[model samples]
Target chain A: MKSVKAFAPATVANVSCGFDILGFAIDAMGDYVEVFRKEEPGLKVISIEDDGGKLPWEVEKNTCAVAIQAMLDDYGQEIGMDIALKKGLPLGSGMGSSAASAVAALVAANRLLGDPYERKDLLPFAIVAEKAACGAGHADNVAPSLLGGFVLIRDYHPLDVIKLHVPDSLYCTLLHPHFQLNTSDSRSVLRDAIPLKHSTIQSGNVAGFVSGLYQEDYELISRSMRDVIAEPYRAVLIPGFYEVREALKAAGALGMGISGSGPTLFALSKGAEKSKEIAKAAEEIYQNIGLGVDVYYSAINTRGAYVLEENK
Target chain B: MKSVKAFAPATVANVSCGFDILGFAIDAMGDYVEVFRKEEPGLKVISIEDDGGKLPWEVEKNTCAVAIQAMLDDYGQEIGMDIALKKGLPLGSGMGSSAASAVAALVAANRLLGDPYERKDLLPFAIVAEKAACGAGHADNVAPSLLGGFVLIRDYHPLDVIKLHVPDSLYCTLLHPHFQLNTSDSRSVLRDAIPLKHSTIQSGNVAGFVSGLYQEDYELISRSMRDVIAEPYRAVLIPGFYEVREALKAAGALGMGISGSGPTLFALSKGAEKSKEIAKAAEEIYQNIGLGVDVYYSAINTRGAYVLEENK
Candidate 1:
């Protein structure tokens, strides 16, 4: 095939207790990347669409282009690609927009290049390329975006990623504000160090959250989906944070936390109807403050990254 | 039945990555508590066996008597018991000495009280009584000792406890030095505050370990069984810890960390034979330092607390 177009979904990283280590994919939003063969060996970004913020046009600077570059560099066969990224997800709203772009581009490139590797095998290249968007090399958002459903980043050094099971009945509700909270700024506000006690408590919650998922215990998930470290620190940055959280909880959200860096809050529940109820309550809280917010209800996206179109 | 006798296994709390939240039971050592009915409604510690140090015989102060008291106080049915403790595990050796006693006494009392509660139900009484052994009311050690296998302490306030799975092939090798590192002293050395990075990494490891258990991925469990919180501070108190850790790793051990708040180092391996090799290497390290050490190789215990004698 001369060209391929693929999409990768936005993911909820941190999952409350599992900061930098856990995430899950949702069907609500995503980004699409189209890759076309270039005559000579190189990578370039030919076009960008629906970008709320100024994204890099240069091949080396853009997440999508950089991801394609990494893939081409690793390919033993001669390859060149021109890329296009269409951002269907909100930028800097913690919905993993750049991650979607990074993952999508790598997937498209791999598709047109005779599919040299498995989708999961593309993780390393995707993670390295995602660093172009976020300064830190973290897989919480990227892994789930690539692998689908829920993923746990066991270790970072040697880079171990494990795909975890997500209950079929699980539902996700996301409320995104019109404004943006840059990933860098959201991370900068977090404490460099946390108290040992807080860490211990957070550890319990993370383990509990995982166990809840396995047992399909909604009560356990709701109780354990607490973020003692990041949420406490970043909650102040999001407007009407506490009120929205209370509203979500009151409306039967299993748990709620900052989706990515904030200006967006993601709440999870059991049924789609219940999740909508939670979404309405949470959105109303943000809307009461005269904020334009977008609420999306989703069942988890089990497919991580996939091809949408191909030209043979 | 006028009296009952039961035994509760010793447990390794913290489990390296899961400080204050995770633990597992092994088949190595335990504590046996025999409870006899008292004429009136009052608790007493009549005698203690295998006392490594002078233990409080007072009903209000001793761990065994205190656990029995808590159980009786919770029961609406009039119940009184005089207790005797046999500490098969070494006291103050980082082998959950007090937790074993606390769990055993609670089990024996519960058994003699006509099994008023389930094995898991006895957790609260054991946790409350464990405070007499260690200042803080934590259940990492006691829960696994009471429930058997591995356990996750999700929350302590409302008292949420979950029993987790353990791989049958996983083997535990513990090398306990003939020295006392009191729980109070061991805990006192820990830093009250830790860096956020450390906490996040530790959280990942804890979640990873739990995932490992479910997946039956020994490599992941070993890699994730890291203790960034407690082991660092307490490692200094133990003799020849580093050498033993290296030796164990070289001998095909998956991971090694301070068992509870050491003097005893716990190492895990893929099989019984490998665990024995790891145990030999660890033991030799302490022996070379002229410190007497006892090595116990065991599989994960599936049984929690069990009755030895009941005349019902």
Candidate 2:
């Protein structure tokens, strides 16, 4: 059988009201995985580049390696394969770098192994690999990277995910401050219990946001996407979170909130022009503080992970 | 001008996971409102019947009268009209009887006054009337009754609402166990705080449900509609809640949950046969315990509130 190659885009988890259930892929930011059949009997990872010397080479610890290993384990005694990863996004940027690698590797491995597992079935394998990397089972990133478009993880058990339609008018601007905010640390700082009234408001917002997506009503979507529960507590970790959000809102962005954990804030706007303006304004705000920040303007990538090419 | 008559179906609030934000109207159960031009200089409510001798005669306190009063307040004077309300649905049965009366009256008044306010504008008036009735501002019932579909209330202030297209295959069965469950009392029993983990799960379920509606995936909708936070805590007030849910599920009902506060249980089914079976099983379960339950099997009402005949 011919070998294959695939690419999985980096995803933004939470998406405000969606929290662990919602995510979307970025078209221009992600990782690539290449898999080729070999006469050797043992699986091997050939190389991993641009990972800042942070990712481990060991199959169990490496996110992409572990994901490919899981696919091999399920399929049983597949021919040995040389796997290569080209990491495009930064590690620990709250941009789903690990999830992109995991999804890419699993997708490439699945394609190489005569596609033993269905596309949706690869989600758990990707999640397992992510758990090995992040030390937790978080599907927000992996689900979108694996399934593409906007994903809602309804239930983790039996692994149920729903892909939501992204409105064409919606554009995203991601501003990543050049500071690290570990997901583990950010999670530990959150309050164990939230006030009842606040939870009600949050639930209301979540419902509103979901309905907004269905109706394609950007105004209602903007009004409903406000998150009071996690963002309020997590915003303290971001240096210029409030100022950036205010500036984006003033520049005609529909809404703004923390992307994934902290340090990366995202805004949704109606048009490319407004989105670019918001992105430019956000960069200026970060620059005023003398902080380095990377900005990306893109639309939601509806296509998730797929086989990019097949070997002859 | 000749009198105009219209009926707005009563709605079930909460809708399980949504709690105070999600609601849908039920056919065959509602209040009828009639509006007519009168010789008097001020608006007057002629008759309000079927209140079980509990509602006040004062226009300021009655749900329908208060809604009409709101329309008048918005217009700066009475529109010189007479309004009559004939209530059919039982009061405090977790079926949003008061909201139906309020919405119906507002629709009638709006038409009589040449619709000085837009259709969406009447929502705030209905919500205000609801506050007068329940002592709180909630849009679950008002939004659905006013909009005539599955509605997600994005925000109450500056009033944002999104209407979703319900799948054609879905059928609803509602069983009201002749009892009262006040919204205020049910709300007061809840704990002052909730676990963050539970909140996250709730958010995931809501997102999943909305995605399911968009995709028209019944299986996903059923699996995602399960409510862990509110149902477990609130179901204790409803007699045989668990038993009825089990019975409905065993009878091939897609999903079942406590409709609104209590007493009323709702089930979603794929077809009329299953809906009837669910209704029958639920009624038998409650009847065995010496409770009289009224069951209604209907599809989603696409028309929210409308005039039966234009005023001549």
| Candidate maximizing DockQ | 1
- Model 2 TM-score on chain A: 0.96
| Clashes by residue pair, model 1 | A193-B195, A193-B196, A194-B195, A194-B196
Clashing pairs in model 2?
B148-B304
- Give the per-residue lDDT digits (tens) of candidate 2, residues B6-42: 7888787777666666788766578888988887766
**Stretches of model 2 off by over 4 angstroms after superposition:** A1-3, B309-312
Q: What DockQ does each listed candidate score?
A: 0.79, 0.69
Q: What is the TM-score of chain B in candidate 1?
A: 0.95
What total of clashing residue pairs does each candidate reach?
A: 4, 1
Superposition TM-score, candidate 2 onto the true structure: 0.95
Model 2 agreement with the true structure over A74-111: per-residue lDDT tens digits: 77785687778889888888889999999998888888
Instruction: Please give the CA lDDT of all the candidate structures.
Output: 0.85, 0.81
Q: Write the per-residue lDDT of candidate 1 for residues A1-312, one digit (tens) a residue.
A: 388999999999888888888899998789999999879977778899999557889887899877777776777666778888898987777888888999999888888878888988899888877787787777888899999998999888888888877888999999888876767778888888777778988999999988888778888889998998888879988888888888889999988998877767899999889988987886678778888899999999998989999998
